[model samples]
Target: MADDFDVVVVGGGINGTGLARDLAGRGWRVLLAEREDLASHTSSASTKLVHGGLRYLETYEFSLVRKALQEREVLLRSAPHLIRPLRFVLPHAPHLRPAWMIRIGLFLYDHLARRELLPGSHGLRLAGGVYGAPLKPEFTRGFVYSDGWVDDARLVVLNALDAQARGAEVLTRCAVTQAQRGADDWQITLGNGRRLRSRALVNAAGPWAERFLRDHTQGANGRPLPARGLRLVKGSHIVVDQRFTHDHAYIFQNPDGRIIFAIPYQERFTLIGTTDVELPEHEEPPARAAIEAAEVDYLCEQASRYLARPVAPADVLWTYAGVRPLLDEGGSASSVTRDYLLEADAGSGEGGAPLLNVWGGKLTTYRKLAEDGATQLGELLGKAGQPWTAGTHLPGGDLGRHGVDMAAFTAELQARHAGRSPAVVARMAHAYGSATAGLLASPGREIAPGLFEAELQHLRDKEWACSAEDVLWRRSKLGLHYTPDERAAVAAWFDAR
Candidate 1:
């Protein structure tokens, strides 16, 4: 078919970006269209953990847990620069789920996957462990487990970059306004008045999946699809001055049954969050205002229950919220499934075009989700390509010879950048992995006072970072460390450049 693309993905979130990379790498012509800048949506607003959703075990989502657990290692290996292991301390509270149940859950979690680099879960004497110094005296016992943290936005960009490098077209600020199936190909119209044709379509539009399908009619075959629906749950997080002494994160259970994380963010700050509340589907740019007084009270109450110092909304330096487009599972917000559901509305024949809709998914399982999506697309398109993303590295993720040995990588980085703080080296190593060499290649030159001029230029030149928010909030958490004046200076430099 003489079409603009073989596959047209309608969202620039992680799922769409990953799928684009997967399909493009498999030698298919692919085009990824995003309404806004990439990762401006839920992709950047995640809890920043590439975990197996350990809590999902309570819901008996074994399959989802297993897939996520397996993907955790895949992500850590592929993007060691942007993803790293994080130790989480779960205090054994008598009021919460019993310790026996927790232990059993942890046991199942460890056994679900063939773990390699990350260590297994272990019981801890909170009074004797490194985390003990920061917690209250009463919390004397806890459990420590491993999960991976990610720079969610960069994950999207890296996938897009990889896809572009492999013969895919990635269009930012281009919205898919309309679509129609024409004979053997799908005709699509963009908001910018551009038209394109594709043999297949993927509605991996995250929150906009339903709307995208609703605006576009069924294909010529008229196959029925599930009435597209999603539960918009707004999750909010607050950033404050660092509160804990150790690097370990804390998973605390609130009285209301929701869980929160106290994570060490950007070295000098703590990230604590997330309250769940139902929101209208039409709410664009899910407002951080929904971070209610009650939610803040709940977070502070939970944090105070464990930490040596008290936390309150007044202590908050920044706050943000994201709407999780969960598949309509007909349950309370907390019980909703985080797994994705794919709806295909294409017929079986020589003159067939397909429309694939993605309902729900998390950051941790994005790659696997994309691979699976590509496999389904292959089936629909009758295209022959073996799955190849499991071992492939994303952009700037090549750790030559060292082979995912973080300790040795950090040691080398510390030696090379002797004048920079150890914490800075560690942060860069975690953010860029072996790619840190590219970031620090110009050793003696200062980028812009606190902001590395080279880093800023690299972001601008390569990462599709157009605004200050794209750099500070999404690309890296350097904003947390920079003063208002310094941030303004960086913004001015970006504008001037």
Candidate 2:
């Protein structure tokens, strides 16, 4: 806490954690300060896919799509425990989008970037195909394409964990209340009344990037960097009982020209989502990223468009929303670019400290974005950055380039543990990977039935979890399955801790 570091990062979301990890791996002493638990906001509330933006092709964003497609493969190799291949079924909707257009889009997605791990896209006859069981009989044909699904929040936490292993300090629930840029360094004051100094600063505060610049980063005696602003678009998701038996996900195109995904989640429920509604102005962060009444109905109607069974609001078991901070390109929320921008100000610090601001990035391309950000920062520091994250494996992901067999690995772990439930074994294999051994050694690892006390304690003691919300919601998606008493019990345990 007394040292002036190489870089002080001001967010703990994907972008910030990615940058911190990259920088620390490059031998930079880094300190990351987060206002709350990591992935507490937009990073956790994602659609949970690591594919190229297939819909961005319709908006003519080829570069972003190609970059994302390339990064998708890198991440799948880097963290295969939490990231795996997922096939998506897109039912042919003649009225919404022409078949030829869809064909062209799929072609680009397959060939945009060099593919190594995933198979190419192809058409499928849905009459007896595995993907048609949940859809109506009218949907006689569809298309299958390759993509990847991820535990988004866990990815961020893993990056932070890797950074810590590389000698970076991560401080959660510690906000940067103010930053005074000096001619050679910056003095930052945190919410908990601690202070630290850094030779450079990186503002990666997602939706609060602009606000942090306007308020916290003033008094530096230099002009504010001209920020390419952000448009806050809120996206929401609802969980329901499993609608389909197949492991594949569905990409349903709405009559309104937007598309949403219904993916298999946690082996018990179908995860349907994502409405792009403009966010309302507020002075403080919204208490909840709750899905609105109309948004719920809208998603249900969209699902019913293809499903044989009518999905109503009452069918929804849980809902979540996240505010996407897109580049303010003056378009409808759905059309905004998923690309990112890194703005580096060399002389903004009164003491010649560099300040870099990050804006507008999607989860799929976070690695590349962090690599580029590191390049810019390295140049400012008179050091050239060599890309290293692509080949390196994150923690618990040592199962080789393509990853381990989930079934075989879980079976072996269950055999070792003897008394662990199959559900707990499988979940641990996916969530903890090779790190499961250390976690299983903790007391009450299974705090409640099916829920591991060790997993919760591991999260709180090591992963910066502070409350039941942090454990159940972001660290793991167990909220939908936990009963009221079970939830209260978890909360009580957190309180005692």
Best prediction by TM-score: 2
Which runs in model 1 stand beyond 4 Å of their true positions? 1-3, 216-227, 281-290, 347-352, 417-426, 443-447
- lDDT, residue 109, model 2: 95
Q: Give the alpha carbon lDDT tens digit for every residue of 264-292 in model 2.
A: 99899999989999875444336457789
The local distance difference test score of each candidate is 0.82, 0.87
Q: Model 1 clash tally?
A: 3
Q: Candidate 1's residue-wise lDDT over 112-199, tens digit each?
A: 9989989999999989667887888888998989998888888898999999999999898899887777677888888888889898
Supply the global lDDT for candidate 1.
0.82
The backbone clash count of each candidate, in order, is 3, 13
